[model samples]
Target chain A: METNMLPFMRRLQGATCTWLVQIAIRENAENLPCYAPMNIIPVKMPITTPPPDTLRCIPEFVLENVVVLITIARRTVKLNMDDADVVNLLAPALTLVLTFMGDSSRTYNPHLRARLAECLEAMLPNNEDDSSSHNNISSFYREQIFKTHPHRFQLVPCLLDVFVGIEMTGQSVQFEQKFNYRRPMYVVMDFLWGFEEHREAFTSLAREAEANMEAVHPPIFLRFVNLLMNDAIFLLDEALGNMAQIRNLQNAQESAAWTNLSAQEREQNLTNLSHTGMLARFDNILGRDTIRTLVRLTAHAPFVFCHPTLVERIASMLNYFLLHLVGPNKKNFKVKDMKEYEFDPASTVLDICRMYVELGKNERFCAAVSDDGRSYSPKLFTLAESVLVRIRGGDLISSLRDVAARVSTIAEQRQRDEEILANAPEEFLDPIMSTLMLDPVILPSSRTTVDRTTIARHLLSDQSDPFNRSPLSMDQVKSNTELKEKIDAWIAEQRGKIAHTSTSSTS
Target chain B: MAAMSPSERRLQKELMSLMKEPPPGVTVDGDQASQNLTLWTVHMEGVPGTLYEGEKFVLQFKFTNKYPFDSPEVTFIGNNIPVHPHVYSNGHICLSILTDDWSPALSVQSVCLSIVSMLKTTAGQFVLC
Candidate 1:
């Protein structure tokens, strides 16, 4: 029962629960008749003003929850709660909320709704919110409560009814009324998802209520996504199941042959599929109309797909899928027709390039892809150029052109460096011009062969030359191209001498 | 312990530890009613003898599934703002621990202590200087 933790909990509950505990202990001091734990209830008292103890304990920030939990817990220390007891307490509790909900639409039903929230709040596994709660229901106690108790608590679905309001019954909730009722519903969802048993039902109810909530409410599914994304039980696949993109994706993914294919095979098939022909591979999974709808949504309201920071994620995922139809490091993903795809890779790159532009609404995202100035293949450059031409984002277009131009220029420089290397002398064999410290200033600067690596090491502590002991920086060194030509000629002469030696030895 | 992901397990341990022996002037609202450990709302009280004493602030922590591996997004929320050099008016803290100085060994408890000490140091300087 963790009786040692009791004092800490009592301290946490502070004055309010302490006052209740003091009264209950004082009244039952000599030991009253002990009842079976499960059947016990709070001592009935008039629903009147303040008890002297409660009057003294009330804090400025009201936490009415502690008083209610202690009221219930005072009767029985370890509450052996069952489904019936939960339903009995909470159903009546909800009714009180609904009745109060009628009288006060302005302030809302704070008095009773807070009590209901408190009741649910008390049953949670111990934490800070429950710190103020005196009930201190053990984790084991809560587990048993759910294990023994079936779905008897009707309060959750009832709250949904109040939340959605006649939507289930085909009656519309008034626009203003819908806005006001969200808080209690939010509270109910928060409490319900805490229980392992209730999460599925909550998600299912969310699915059913989604259609009705479109106009008045932000998609309630997002709340669950926000909470459930980290949970192993709720995969990203399941979270996005209702979205057309995921639905179409799932249809394509669940294909028998597609599922059975090895990852290499799947990567091949998807990469090979023609842009319009790509619809054929997915057609086995989803209808043409569904794929069309999925594409349309992406083209239209792309923001609907954005879950907090998922814009980048979806963009990267599309790039990956376009590149290799399978997920990163994922295997056992198999595909058929391994040998047959010979169309332009640009088509596939361009497929995702559109969304890349769409996602480039974030200036930072645009700069990362567009301004890198790395040369792409002629195919990708054509695609990028055409994409830049289409997107019309001013910053992006100039950057894309700049990156393409820079990459080509870099490519030309690299080719020149290679040509210079083919003819270089033995003295210039080292790439960093490490063998000779030829000065860029063109004076009698370390004409003797000096390894630049040694100078670089010295420059780490002392940014000066080792030999002359003068001020020197790595930037000050230049390659001795004359020595490079001499080395190349020497290497050619050495090769000729080796050829002459081999022929003479054979004779 | 092995069953939970590193982030989940670490968060669980931190949650229990935080509840058991929380940092002074710091309390996390134990409303894990979402059962999602990735997000937390922490309540902090300005140390009693400080310039910002008697003030209450709430900090929202958003942790990804790759947390510890990835740093949590911690930002202050509420009407009250502590006028400190390291704290932005927009509630983005300029603390190194949140960015370049982050290490996986640092938990919610340590972060809370770091923030408390930062505030204390600032308060001490404000008074003495």
Candidate 2:
């Protein structure tokens, strides 16, 4: 069965060779139209003379195939294949003859010479092997196969692959050792063939090295890796034409996706708002927890927050919720301050207590109390007293009530005083009332009534006694007039001082 | 120290042309007596409207043996540290152009301008290395 298979293999090899040769002839003839009939003829030409360009056959292909077969045979022999088997194998036999022709130094037909060089190269050992046989075959291939078919398209890639494999295996040392005993022509051929065939592979290996660089740990290795990657990139760039088709396709797809999604999203948002009642649903959807989570996430992923669109969305949402919660009049509350627990109602109570403490330090409370006294309203007094008590207890509600009481008291007192003045005689009330009002110790209510006469008299008499002592009713009139004048003068002086201070400070 | 070679003299003349006329808040200076004109000392006034405003900084530039063919080694000098995430406490700047993005087309003057621009345009409290 093995013997039967051998003949069949030989036939298959012959058929493959015939097909490859035909393809090469056709391709070459296409470039040199005059040699079409010669390409159809399979007759072997003499190796001594250069083939005429008119023949139009790629001699390099035939030579390369022969060298490749010879190398394969040698590899098989190393594994203990019989010499008779190699001679009988059509592919191997053809390869050996081509390799010999390529190895010969004699000048021949230019095309045949180049083809011979390629065959010799195919038989040459890679940098990984550098064996004597490999060196000899490689030099022969360069001179014969490569020189003849320098422009052979397939030969370049095939040679490159062999070279790349050797480099990747780290067998340069073995290659050098083997090549040392070989002819200079063979050594040079091995290098050239290795570079041409393995250019891409070498580059890829280099790129892999660069990708795995450890600058400190392996400086030399890193440099080597970078060099490999750079060479690979350079070769690839030349091998592959500009990839405009792929880029254009990618761009089109991206644009389509973007536009389609954007339009769909806009429509979806509008529909959602209409169906769900925009404001109410939006508030329900994004609860306090959700907003808090968003803020936390934004803080963690600052890059997201850096996006203007994202920032605007968050800001708008925050403003919307705040406006709803605090009404327009209280908008200033949001800007005024931020406390850790202010977001919690319980903590807001503490802030209120602090505010009341601040308000208590102002003397405005005195005016409220005096106004309350004049009205003598139990309800107003009770409210004020309750607020004061609450404030003392450090309750925020107390501060709120205190503010309300003071504002109401001042307004009510002013109204009542206006009503009284409207009914009373100007001369009778104005002079006495104005004089009493000027006294700091006298309340507005006390100033209107004479029932607190003793207190009023002491207050009026203690200060320089502007009204002179006199006997009866007439003296009382004069004393009252003089006292009113003196009181008015004192009030005017106080007013002037206050006005000057305010102006100076404001400027 | 070795005397400046002819090539080094040519490079220095080329570098001088590339240096910009100092803008409102930028300055440049170089060592004159050094044998290698590739090494330069640069001073810059911080651009206003930045966190580093009103501060002065110094930088050192050491071109490789293959100037124009390779990038320069730039480092900050003095104590005025750049408080940026990309800028190390030791004053080593981690800009792309100084490393992977470096091209032969880039000049010392353009690099300085780019650094100033980077400081100006960044709005965050922290920078990205």
Candidate 3:
């Protein structure tokens, strides 16, 4: 078999020669031959190979030799062996291959040919230069390259690898000059669109890539991180939006559910739900970082458009984090050490109660005992009542009354001080008086001595002005008094009816 | 379904009122008459000084059958999403009070406010899992 390497070389030499001749006809065709012999042999041999695998393999060895020779030849001919050599050689080949593949009359598998072309494209200069050509390259990928061979878009990884190589070899300045115009966002957006188009596959790839982050080269790793971070934030926002919608639906449904329950049943149900055990599970899910991302994503969302459940989710996570922070076994711990604490409900409650005492937040103390009217545990109520009574002289009611009295005294003192100040010379009164008077004694006493019965009576009482010296106006006070009296009367009537019924049953 | 008890009715009305006149910078939507009114859909516009600025996000809320007394379940709704470190891609949130240390006194409004503030203060930072 007589092999006609001449015809092969002619064809390989054909395009470059034609392009050079066209330029030469205008300037100098003599320079064309100098560039021709170097590129012709390598490119021609690969094209003439009988097998596709042989053709594909040829570039590995042939490219380097051809590139070096082409570089030397270009310097000899044009006085510069710049990126123009690679661009001129690769671009024309790419254009030719792409155009050929796009032509429907060609019967060969365009997909395979496109894939092969991509492999070759990956070998081209990965410049760091921020140039118009770089932007054009990126846009080309986004518009033509990606569109033609969507599956082969993974070639981005290879392209990125080449860029990393260029960066590592100290050619970054030159590369940047060529490619710097391409924004990171463009590559990121391209990856995102590709990922979205193939979600499951991309997700797996992402996971795999993340798992292998340590093995990746520094520049490629950084690019991957940048891409991942951007995508993660974008997806988080989207996920959060969907979650908000679901939450709103859930809240509306829950309200309807609550309405369907009887008053007693509703109270019982709410009480049961408020139990520490149930809340713990709820917290576990919401307090996870995932919920934070969602909440943070839609925190300022408009109420009508925002998820109603966002608040609930945030509340759940906040409460959970706080519980972990201040709950029993959590004391003497820094925020960093919170996860070390064992989650014990009983201990957590005790810790909370102790904290309330330490902080002198009476409101919180009262809240712990009466979280929900129906679910107030007899044991917890007794314990709280005992603690209150022990501190407040064996009277829960009196303790509240004392707090009320103190509050009133403070208010009156504030009023008196203000009145005196208004009338007095500015220099006469001490400037320190306002601070002293306004400073609330957060810790009123070591403990309260209020019993359960007394606390209940105070709660139920109509005439008992527990928080003495009300803040309301006379008319408002009168109206509140009337309302309280009606409530008290109704309660008394109900009690009397229950007593009568019990007595009749006993008889 | 049986008629609602007065207390339940009051809760329903309160929920309705919240939906109709949600606090400023908050928006909510979902099925109105569904059996699980506890769940809802929400969209939030990004506030200034946050990483989420100029972005819209979604959330899902699933209230326990015991709601108000018990906090609802909230989760993010997307896959492989970008988020601040504070946010988990798994839809978990890291806010305080939703867990064991909850106070019944904290309302839905306050929770949302806290989240908004978190976004404002943290800006580019995120919660770590």
Candidate 4:
């Protein structure tokens, strides 16, 4: 446990191959199998617990040991790619590091753990050389790792903690940091993609965690959702920032200074602008990847993605990005400003809309996105169509077209609602927001009626009647059943008018 | 229209009403606000008979996506922020309605009226000080 023992162990570890021998003995006890590239042998090691004292090291020391072991495993695998026995020798050591990931009491650095995970995947016996043996080794290691903790999954959630920090602080780790801050996220998606069991386990955990956001220990999945949305927001903001830069440079080129500049200086300026465009293009790639992960995650669990606040947040992001993609009047989606500087966010857009389209395919998710039972954000539907039309043909096109058809149906219903509102008496509207009330509830203290959603949202932050400033809670509000009946009848009347008008026009 | 949030719909209605029948001494710059619903600027001229009479002021309103449920950030924005007991040099106002006393029933028009009246009464009382 002594801090100085770490450096001594590091030196001793370097001096001898004793660490590998110890790991081999440990693996022998567990009967864990190791696979050579084209050959297979199930190595049997009896399972035994390490000494109690060995498990009692300080957390920081454990972290250093983990880092050292991960480096060795990575280098061992890379240098011995053709030597399956050498690569296979590091399996037990790698699993031990993974088990270290299960120790909840200690916080392992996410970047290091991510590297360890990537190294584990790389160390998997070559898939083509020995398929059955690869499955056995991978499955056994996964079971051992999952058995290390009560929850059965640790590494991914722990890795996601870094992203949770980014969401809360609103500052992402810069791309320049060693191993880069985003390495864990990329590794997480890659890890999940490598193993189907991991994806299934992750989807279930995400659903469980989502249902309990206010739990004492908030699940990393909800924060992960926030992180994905935040990434989209920040990436789009970066794109907008780059667009502004391009505009400024274009303006500068048009200004009187352009003619005054020497030819050499002009070339330098043009090069700098193109470089900026390249950065924008790089951001688009990152954006597209993030959206792909988001879409995949959403497909796994629509309920988690359709959580009310998240649904709203995602809709807002789509709205902003789509508006930018398709300029005003829905034309000018693809903009080519400078040669070799083409920045099209269409792929990212398609990914996001693809997510929306997928979510819309589910009835419950559609209702969640639009609580009023009409349609999801009409503006989003409008904006998406503007872009979807420009796309020639693809699976995304057919799916998005389906969403458009649904939106039109909802639009007709909405038009009927608007007609009802136009004829609605002032008393039918929510006094606070001035919208036609749905599920009106009367405040006891203020003697005012507002829509249920409006009041519920208001009470979340401040438990007071907005009209009277008197302390109030949702439980005290009474439903305005009489007004509800009147509004229903009124809407029916408007629907009749719409039905007549539509029939007449068709005939 | 279907996708517009409750806050957006409310703001749209308020914008139209304010444009069609603006209150005395107040006019909203509609064209500027047409770009985004969450932010707006209103032009206010000092009410007659007040110490700030003939003085012009600009108020900026910033609404969150959750607007009616949450109070907008209201501040005196332009060069002629009023000199008053409740007005900070940085254009922040200390009026109660801008904070805890705010009601969802209040609109941009009501907030503008409150600021104008605050300028009149507060500046009147402190004019001789």
Ranking the candidates on lDDT from highest down gives 4, 1, 2, 3
For candidate 4, the per-residue lDDT at A208 reads: 84
- Which is better, 1 or 4, measured by TM-score? 4
Q: Rank the models by DockQ, top first.
A: 4, 3, 1, 2
**Which ranges of candidate 1 are over 4 A from the true structure?**
A1-507, B1-3, B123-129
DockQ of each: 0.01, 0.01, 0.02, 0.35
- Score residue B42 of candidate 3 by CA lDDT: 59
- Name the docking class for model 4: acceptable
Number of the predicted model whose DockQ against the real structure is largest = 4
RMSD of each: 28.8, 40.7, 29.4, 9.6
Flag the better candidate by TM-score, 2 or 4: 4
By TM-score: ranked, best first: 4, 2, 1, 3
Q: Compared with the true structure, what per-residue lDDT tens digits does model 1 show for residues A292-363?
A: 222333444445434223333343344333323212221222223322322222333344455544544544
After superposition, which runs of candidate 3 have C-alpha atoms over 4 Å from their true positions? A1-483, A486-507, B5-11, B30-35, B79-82, B123-129
Candidate 2: tens digits of C-alpha lDDT, residues A58-122: 44455444445545555554443343443333333333333233322321333333334444433
TM values, all candidates: 0.24, 0.30, 0.23, 0.66
Candidate 3 residue A242 Cα shift, in angstroms, is: 37
lDDT of 4 by residue, A1-507 (tens): 565654454454333233322332232123325321122223322223442222333344434454455445434533422333333334344434444432332233444444444444444333343323334444355434433433334445544554554333223334433223454456445545556666776677787877774344446787777777777677667766776676667677989999999999999889978887887766655665567778788777777766654666665565566656654633322334633444555665676677768777765444444434223445656666666667642557667767656656655656656655675788888877787887888999988888876776676567788887888876788999999999888877777887798899999
Which should have the higher lDDT, number 2 or number 4? 4
Model 3, A231-310: lDDT tens digits are 33333333333333333433533776768868888676545433522333333322232222222222222121111212
- Minimum summed lDDT over a 10-residue window in model 3 chain B is located at B1-10
The better-scoring model by DockQ among 1 and 4 is 4
Q: Model 2 over residues B1-129: C-alpha lDDT tens digits?
A: 112332254356545554545445655564451455767777887888787889898887887644543568888879897776667889898888787566433567768887887777665644565
lDDT of 4 at B111: 88
Write out fnat for all predictions, comma-separated.
0.00, 0.00, 0.00, 0.53
Q: TM-score of chain A, model 3? A: 0.20
